[model samples]
Target: MKLVLAIAPDRFRDEELFVPQKAFADAGVETVIASTKTGTCEGMLGGAAEATTTFVEVAPEAYDGIVIAGGIGSQDFLWGNNDLIRLVQTFAKDGKVVAAICLSPVVLARAGVLKGKSATVFNSPASVSEIRRGGATLTDRDVVVDGKVVTANGPFASKAFAASVLSVLSPISP
Candidate 1:
């Protein structure tokens, strides 16, 4: 099965995380939630879900793609996490799709990917800087797909986020 991995920390945006997750599921692509730790991770909305898996920690070549979730937890949990960075880069180098949405597009820049790719972030200063530094053309849309990397604006745009991810998973519409 094509693995679509969603990366998150203890606290990630609920809508941004799940919307794309369910999209992967809808496309029959198996998804696994990877966290820095093994415990149940809390969502930005105030609830939690169990992380069924942890980072490969060995080989990033295992997953077909990686989706990074954005939120306060990204700063708290993933700020200094090098494994996450390595994973994003590994997937990107393999020509695998990498996606990040909301305030998390910084992860893409730090991963050293998304360079010269058109993208979007949540209209935050950090996001703007990261996108520019990465040589990406930023758009003012809810969802922006630059090559294999897809980004969404915020929680309000989950529907478009899911649709975009779905389109990435299966290149054709039925």
Candidate 2:
């Protein structure tokens, strides 16, 4: 089965986390929630759900793709995470899809994954600079699909973000 892994932090935007989770689940993909610690994760949109699993470390090779949900927590972890950066870089280098939305792209860029690829995020020029500095094509849109790397904007783009992920994972029957 195609494993859709959501690397959810302890605090992320509600729609950013759950919308894509629900999308992957509805698409018949086996979804797994990987958090910093194994337990219930608090969402920014006033929702709470327990993570199915937690890992102190992630190799990024076991899953078909990794979606790093973004919010305040992601911003906090955006930089200075050598491990997470290495993980995202490794996943992308292996030709595996690695996606991030909102501020998480800042993390992805810091990991050197977004360099030269088109992507989107939730923040402003400073955030785009982070990705651009990594050599990525930063876009101010709801969803940007540059190769296997997909990214979305903010909470308002939740539906489009989920649809973009679905489209990337599996295009329509038509």
Candidate 3:
């Protein structure tokens, strides 16, 4: 399966990007890194990754899932990006797996995809208020999955967040 992983140009939480990426890779999922521009993006903790594509280049239909990595930069760069918001909305409408960790859930909130859904994000006033205002029932859980939408609180929940995403994309039969 293929997935698009979106991050900011800089300061994306290192674990939020790397942990889920490793989980996806271990599950045989192909990930395409996307950002506002094509180049290397530095994580808050000094990790670096190269963005292979720009937001304008992402085609929702080309992948089975979308994951947005969050950090302080996400609040700065991704919150008001119309293209990224539209892309997240498209993924939700398509019934594709959509996951966001840390502060990135605000993008989903801004996309109108979180309406009436249950989700969680890092405990910040802006993040909480925006999510609730978007119509999601904000939860304090480490991870919450409402149908195809998966959300995690912060970096500490990255692994569980990824596992939830994998379960959505590739469910294990009883």
Report the number of clashing residue pairs per model: 0, 3, 0
Candidate 3 colliding pairs: none
lDDT of 2: 0.72
Off by over 4 Å in 2: 170-174
Pairs clashing in candidate 2?
Answer: 115-135, 116-135, 116-136
Q: 1-174, model 3: which lDDT tens digit per residue?
A: 899999999999999999999999999999999999999999999999999999899988788978999999999989998989988989888888889999999999999999999999999999999999899999889999999999999999999999999998953132
Candidate 2 per-residue lDDT, tens place, 64-100, comes to: 7777788777766535566667767777887777788
**Model number with the top TM-score:** 3
In candidate 3, stretches whose alpha carbon ends up further than 4 angstroms from where it belongs are 170-174
Best of the candidates, lDDT: 3
**lDDT ranking, high to low:** 3, 1, 2
lDDT of 1 by residue, 8-79 (tens): 656788877777677767777777778886668889787676677666443565666777778877766664
Against the hidden reference, what TM-scores do the models get?
Answer: 0.87, 0.86, 0.96
lDDT of 3: 0.92
